[model samples]
Target: MTQHVTVGIDGSVQSAAAAEWAAREAHRRGLALRMIHVAGTEADALERELGGGAELPGRVAEICDGIAAAWPGLDVTCEVQPGHPAYTLAAASGRAELLVLGSRGLGGFTGLLVGSVGLRTAARSLAPVVLVRAESGRTDAPAAATSADATSADGAPADAAPGDVVVGVEGDRPCDAVLEFAFERAADLGARLRALESRPTSHDVYTTQAPVEQAEIRESLAAAEQVRLQDALARWQDKFPQVRVEVEVCPWSASRALVEASRGASLVVLGRRTARVPLTGPHLGPVVQSVLHHAHAPVAVVPHH
Candidate 1:
């Protein structure tokens, strides 16, 4: 069966770029593209001005109709939903191969402060979410054209090495899957894979068994923890022999660490296997959401794969 990717669109230029990006991706992967928009008070007013019926579904159909016209041969569907944009988009993610949203939406704020829909979907959605910021052109172009766009996003100097595939790694089992996915992506792009482990705060409180004792034990356990992290990196390198790997351990929050590491990266890949890694969950995890919100590089979430 052909895969399906859903992109949130609200007729903004960024959203249009997202739609074009999704369409190009669908074409490349032989998949269908679905464009969705949640009817907020603002969107409702705009549709009314355009003589669209003052209803949620009508606005949705209007958006989808435009997408269908843009890429006549490809399969495209538009949906208008009620309630919060992030909630609806994240729920739709369960059925999609990927969920996409532009960094800035028809809503307010630009640059670092991404729209809530993009932020929430990236952090909470079960499907991989691609948070994109468009170039001066569209995503529906030939391979060489699209590649040039991708390269421009990376800001790579002509003589420098290609961009790397950056992924977050920790003690969770999900890190294993993340490493595997990142390695494959790096190999496919002929890029290096950079893995980072974000250390938690209260670093000295090493005692998990007894809260009081743990406070006193942190100093003793800190060095050992660093060694354990090094071992994890060594194991990953051993497993992916063909790929070049660089590992770093940082004492920053996971979100901050990811944002810093994502600089100049071709793609930032995050793992979403909350059942096995509950700390990274819907509506809660800061690290997952922060990367989605702040990273200038394109972010890719690997959902339980």
Candidate 2:
């Protein structure tokens, strides 16, 4: 790992918020902070100037300076690179321990769509990617964390009590890397870990079973799911004994369950396949794509084989 946190800066409020979040995260991880602004070379400068993007460099500089002064002794650097935004950031992820980007807002990524920079970079990133949302009314993040504050994105105030770090677990396709990331993050924040698994309730129209029988069937399925989830989390729980682990087995859509869990969570984590599947899903699973767009908390997309 490169031992640094990389954040894309575009001078928007959302990007500024992302920069602030990345700075705190860098401090927590004891890593350097790198702020990169992407605009084409001299040849493309005229286009940028004509397009009214000339002021971005100055704004990026100001943001960098503010963060640097606020967190003394932090190695913060700003650079202007020339290339496509998505491709450049994806490449940077290869050399970064984590990549942070601004979510929907003015001049920020409006959506994690198929042709958008956010989705493209997240899909191709070598390291984990975190998407931060900062709207006009969003509170300014503190320069340093003085307390165990777990401000949430889903309507929780800045001074709200610490919240759990929720992680979605695919029982059938259990991913150790995803679990490891979640455990490490929970340990870092000294927060609780909620391992949630959502199952689609079975509905057999052809069956002539009684209503009581159906209830029993559903109960049995839930029990089996609970056991599976517990088994999958056993090793991780042992590894991070300090982290309080809570498991949930619900009969509902995975995306819906995850979105609901994100409401009061400090951070939401899910896994993505290392290989791109080339579909509307950004090569990421459907559930992941949905959660990325709708998640109330900052979502961490971890890549695994």
Candidate 3:
């Protein structure tokens, strides 16, 4: 089947944001956009029909219709599926280029952009899953687009130059899948790629070593970390020559470093390391959980071995 970009919609501010972001992405990739909402029971269906909330299917269709109107030639389609929301979305991820979900700032100031279902869907998704934060007052309309008509072929505001793509990589090893997605996205948008590698906080070179010796050991370790970062990115950099690369060897924690870099980023790419490592399902790591809690931009979690 032809690859497409999919976004899960529930008629919330966050879901609206995800739909717009997904539209732009689909436009950029020259792929069709699929918007889906999962409602499993008669009660759920009745709630949509009567609750009058954003989760209503008709409301979602109205939103999709508006986006399709804005992007004349963009192929936009909406579907209401029947099943467990999380499992349904996770299954949808397997068929699309990537699945996008709205981050309603779930957990408020304490945690995740996505709610419980979103978290489970993201963790279990076969392919990558992107979480988009909802902008206040944002709706089905084109308000989120930059000023000056807020319409462009790439589905972004005309003057809205894309932001840099931030990706986290381990100093000890490289994940080709994650790097590939990051570099490809950078190349597509002509955005810079900021690769981050955090050095562990524990700089315990030795217990009895003098301060000077400890300092030297720290310097040596930092150097090694830098080398590893370079080694990890060398091949990807070559593959995406047009993508400008910036390497950051952070002195802070991995989650903190990535979260900081996420500021104003077009996208933040992370590798999903899990014991199962299967397409069926996998749980999120602690670092991924923390970053999800705090990232300021859309976060892409790519499943990999």
Candidate 4:
């Protein structure tokens, strides 16, 4: 079967944004788009909260229809399944090229961008999961085209120039999958690639020592880190010569740097290690969790060994 882009819809604003983003991605990858809606067991709760009928099938149909009307000629389909939301989406991810979901649900706390379903699905999905926010213009809205009526072949707004794709690098871990995904995306979009590495300030080097000593230690550490970053990216850079890469080494927490980079990025990519135990629950690092909750742009979490 042909691999397609999959997105979970739950009749919320953020989910609608995710669907729009998925449609654009499907067009970019030359793949089909699949929208899956997993109906919850609490029908009454959904009705009371969403102000809909007892069943959610109608809501799902409405969303599908809206997307179809907005972007004509795009191959789009919808499925309504009855099961736990996170598990069903995770199963669907096995067959999808990429899985997209909203950062938060309708009833989540105001401060929480990602809900339990999104968190679990991101950790459990076999494929990369992207959490998109409602205000993400690159995905949720479109940039201006050449002409007022100009649009892409798949009906997305045509951009004069695409934005850069950014990936967070953990120097201590192997991130082949993460780098591959980032490079592929940048190549597909004809955009630039940015590799960001964040290093924490070492107390051992920056303690209450002499200013000269601290400056010397910092310079030595920074030089070493730059060399390591270059070594880590050498292979990937050779593999993707067409991709223009800009590397940065920041002296801050990885999560902070990624969150800051997301402000102007088209997409931010991160990695999650698969749990060794079969029954273990979602395992997300602090950096991934922080970016998922704070990044303004779409965040892609790729699972790696």
Best by TM-score: 3
Question: How do the candidates rank by TM-score, highest first?
Answer: 3, 4, 2, 1
Clash numbers, per candidate: 2, 0, 0, 0
- For residues 1-305, what per-residue lDDT tens digits would candidate 2 score against the true structure? 34899998776666777787787788777799998887754644875767745444666667777677666656888887779888899999999999998777333452542236777788889999998777446654433332224433422223434578999998777799989999998998888999999887778533445556767776876898899889989888898999999999877798999989988788899998886564654477779888878777788999998
Model 3 TM-score is 0.86
> What local lDDT score does residue 284 receive in model 3, on the 0 to 100 scale?
89
Q: Return whichever of 2 and 4 wins on TM-score.
A: 4
TM-score of 4: 0.85
List where candidate 2 sits over 4 angstroms from the true fold.
Answer: 40-44, 47-56, 105-115, 139-161, 205-212, 278-282
User: Where does candidate 4 stray beyond 4 Å?
Assistant: 44-59, 105-111, 136-150, 153-156, 205-213, 277-280
Window of ten residues with lowest summed lDDT in model 1:
151-160
Compare the candidates by lDDT and give the number of the best one: 4
Candidate 4, 1-305: lDDT as tens digits: 67799999987768877887787788777788999988765873576478654344655566677677666767888877767999999999999999999875223454566978888899899999999887623332221221235577656655456677999986656489999999998888788998899987776746654557777878888888878887888898899899999888898888889988887688999999886565666678878988898887799999998
The TM-scores of all predictions, comma-separated, are: 0.64, 0.82, 0.86, 0.85
Q: For model 2, what is the alpha-carbon lDDT of residue 168?
A: 91
- lDDT (Cα) of model 2: 0.78
Comparing candidate 3 with candidate 4, which one achieves the higher lDDT?
A: 4
RMSD of 4: 4.7
- What is residue 68's positional error in candidate 4, in angstroms? 1.7
